[model samples]
Target chain A: MASVETTRSGGDTGLPDLVLRGMTLGYLGWMVVLPIIALGFQSLVAGPQAFLDAVLDPQAVHALKLTVVTALVMVVINVVMGTATAWVLVRYEFPGKKVMNALIDLPFAVPTVVTGLMLVLLYGPSSVLGTILGTYGFSVIYSQPGIVLALLFVSYPFVIRSVQPVLLELDRAEEEAAATMGASGWLTFWRVTLPTLAPAIFTGAALSFGRALGEFGSVILVAGNQPMKTKTTPLYVFGEIESGNKQGAMAVSLVLLALSLGVLISLNLYQRRWSLEDGK
Target chain B: MKTRVQGLAFFFLALGVGLVAGCGGSSGPDASGDVIKLGAYSVVREAFHDALIPAFQEHWKQKTGRVVRFEESYNASGAQARAIASGFDADVAILSHTGDMNQLVEAKRVSPDWAKNPTGGIVTHSVVVIGHREGNPKAIADWSDLAKPGVGVLYPDPKTSGGARWNINAIYGSAYLASKAAGGGTPDLAAVADLLKRVQANVVNMDASGRQSMSSFSERGIGDAVVTYENEILLRKREGKPIEYVVPEATLLIESPAAVVDSSVEKHKNREVATEFLAFLTSVEGQKILASYGFRPVDQTSPLLPEFPKPAKLFTMADLGGWDEVQTAVYGPKGLWTSIFSDQGK
Candidate 1:
């Protein structure tokens, strides 16, 4: 790693470095920045009053609140379950461990629509389990829980993948020292290991939260898309666009885009801080 | 590392060339025949693709001694209208309602006088009705039955579905007409709004489209009843699905419009073929094909009319003061239907 860094720094002034940098920035500007600017412009095209009305519409507000709440729920669950899965993968020797490791990424590969359909088939009213649950006055599909479930499925791999590498590279020396000092396994994890994993956990949580905010395909199927009830922001945006309320669609979309941008930027800053502390 | 980078560049270049070649292959019109692009609502896709297009092709060939190819595009009505208005370049537009067609007119893609024809430019007709599971477990007979407690109903969100607007309009119109009859010509807006709110409260799922609502009712078995077009239920039953529907005694008539997009027809030099296609849609042969697909023909005297039972108090948009008034009263900002959802959230 040191040698590679030395070579890179040695050639930092070369034509290839400049070309690569320019190409990356140019590609990113065209693909990502340009579209975001266009969306920003369109959202304000009808003037600030129209933009405010669209954003402040009761249905839009409810949809935005629902999306944020569901995404938060998904992020909380992902952080706990994902950290445990990563820990188990790093510390335990179990049958099918290799397969389980690979399976963690299956959610990423599967189309989000298929993910929604799978959830619906599993927990929809027609299924036996869903029927039993319904008989007990519990429904999953076409309700709030279904929205969270869909969000969870689509964002499942974020935390696990983010924390797994950090867990793997973690030295056991600190954990052993804590153990020698009469710390319990859970205590050692909390005091010695958890601090090291905190940044990674936050990274995963933020990424999944960002991803869950924009999730549509799976959420739409399971959400039932009742305005001010089950509809999330993305679905609301879709409804607005289809209904010819283009201003409302653009306004809500800008909110989501801003939120996702905020998450990524914060993640970048947090990681930079961590790296600076590591350099110390 | 440098060689790897060069290899990656070459790969991307090859992929770009391949993509360009693939796109170029299919986009050009055939040299030997004329092409007419048809942008239509999704519900008419089966009728057009399976029967109308082929029949028209044969007729045109026999009459003009030239082969004419069709480029078909079908989407939900509003989306299709928006697409054509925003330059989909479809030579013809067949949509679910005049409101969508009006959108094209406003965009100047279609002429305002497109409706100056024998059928008022409408190609097909249907009535809003209630679709239920076989055996009529819910005993749903009218719009008010959908508002009954403990009965789950399905309809698409009107914000996204032109069909949902029709469904909701049927419910609202039935109530409004009843109030008008009782009050000796004064329609009670409050009663209409009340009925809409009650039915919406019973709606278990508001799918994105009418087709999705039907699937949710039939395939997923989620709802006890579905408010949809009469043609949708008939089409399903004809496809061997065990579904039954009831035409409410008082329901709104669904008149779907079609027209030659003047801009696109002129651009494609397809005025003659496009004009003929619209003419054929109202002709006896075209009406028969549409009727076979469960759509009520615009020509009330057509032989296929016998298959469609007439509702006792059938009402067109004119009964509610036409599309412009209905749009503002039912679906506009602060509209009755729009406010119902917001009021529920409170």
Candidate 2:
């Protein structure tokens, strides 16, 4: 009876379990690993020298720079605004609070392409606001600012969703204790609250940054797709494919994949370290 | 008790498998017995959906007393072509230009003799035209006008859009002809490249396809003028959208091609019908349908649509060394477009 129980629960049910593990591994190998491997292989088709040239091309470099710059700006905006929003929803009670909280997730619910269209409708050249801005020689649509705007909308909810739960579970006693010691509100938030919330905030920022890195649909519409000027890496990859240069596309895509994976791994490690410190 | 738990787990697993099996039964190709799969460029969606498909369906039913289904997918012409080449399993492809169709031919999905077919390999035609606001506020008249310093032009990126490739070629072709006529010598490549550079400088938005770029012009009112297919302008005007367009004096006539994907049709055992469908598109009735939808009929025998004004200097892809040469010189790796924008600042 003990042996049967062990086999059923802890010991792996032998042959069937082995088969199931194999199936799961095979499925992932087929779906995820194979495509990435294929891309890597295809990138090497024109030899390593050609692959390097394709990736290091002047236009490719500009696109990468633009993608990174926009994504970083988006991260900054999302982290600040998203944290403030989550803080308000968790700490303060205001009219339409529930609706406001619900609205924060609208970016996640709507398609990315539609987000671009909405931005254009609100900020395009002919709209009242857009016209006003244009009259002042400050264009938003079809520029770097437009790319950042699209990225901000698509990635706004990531940080908020990540930090909300942690904020909810945080103890308020420490803050009250700080207040009793005659600590100012800002001082309490900076010293007592921020340190505790740092890990969650970091985790959320990393997620938003990672998502913004791969943002294509929304940015494609707003970026104006000017080569070397407003074009992003994904758009460049798309252009390469359209021009029948699949090898170039694959090489650039592999670079993006590696960057995203590196960030993800770093984020995990960082979160783990912070959580470990908190335990002590 | 442990055995009972294991037994329950097994029961749930089997139930899940059964449910999955039930859901998957209707998803195979069994139901596609009489379906004609079409993968086409996005710009032709309206014409295909409204007139062409229904007419084809009626024609098939009347001839064979059997109903047929059309499974269609539409996207930018380059994307659609790439999809078919990469095994999207499309039986027919109606693409925007010869470049995309030639991509399929290079992949052997289409026959090499595609150009010599009954349809003249050219299925329907339109010239690149300038679309402006209702009152022609910008007063954009010709290709040269688009390059003016303050003019904001909207066109799709040549990399992803078949239509944009044609538009780019038209601009370059026009410049070449103008230069040739002025000097009475070989067409100057530098002059053509310079014109393209100027036009690119004035471009405010480069969307993925012609339709999307037109939307930026008409809907967002982003650009002062737009370069797009003439038929699109006509189609929009017919829909009561306030748009006016002009046919440049010297413009490239876009020859949109339609062909049967030989391998896909052969694999699906629908080659005869696919060939018949291609033939149908060039038929008198099909040409009429195309004309009604604003496409200049490939069948020149058909009466011309009065709304489609004749350009003083019209040219085909043949006038500019066909798709392969044009693609190589203008849009190939390290081509003219790449060189022109290579030093552009961030």
Residue-level lDDT tens digits of model 1 in A1-280: 0012333554457787888889999999999899999999989989999999999999999999999999999999999999999999998999999999999999999999999999999999889889999999998998999999999999989999889989999999999999999999999988999999999999999989999999999998999898878999999999999999999999999999999999998888888788789893
The superposed Cα distance between candidate 1 and the true structure at residue B264, in angstroms, equals 0.8
Tell me, by TM-score, which candidate is best. Answer: 1
lDDT of 2 by residue, A123-205 (tens): 87788888999889999988899999999999888888878988899999999999999999999999999887787788888
Q: On residues B1-346, what C-alpha lDDT tens digit does candidate 2 reach at each position?
A: 9999999999999999998998798455665347789999998898888998899888888887767788889988888998999899999999988888888999999999888876678788888988887788778889989998999998898888888888889998888778887878777778788888999999998888788888878877778889988889878876888578888899999889988899998888888777778888888888788887788877555464334567999998888788888888887666777789775655
Q: What does candidate 1's lDDT look like per residue over B15-58, in tens digits?
A: 99999999998886678877899999999988899999999999
Interface RMSD of each: 1.3, 1.4
Clashes of 1: 0
Kindly provide the TM-score of model 2 when superposed on the true structure, using C-alpha atoms: 0.87
For candidate 2, give the docking quality class from DockQ: medium
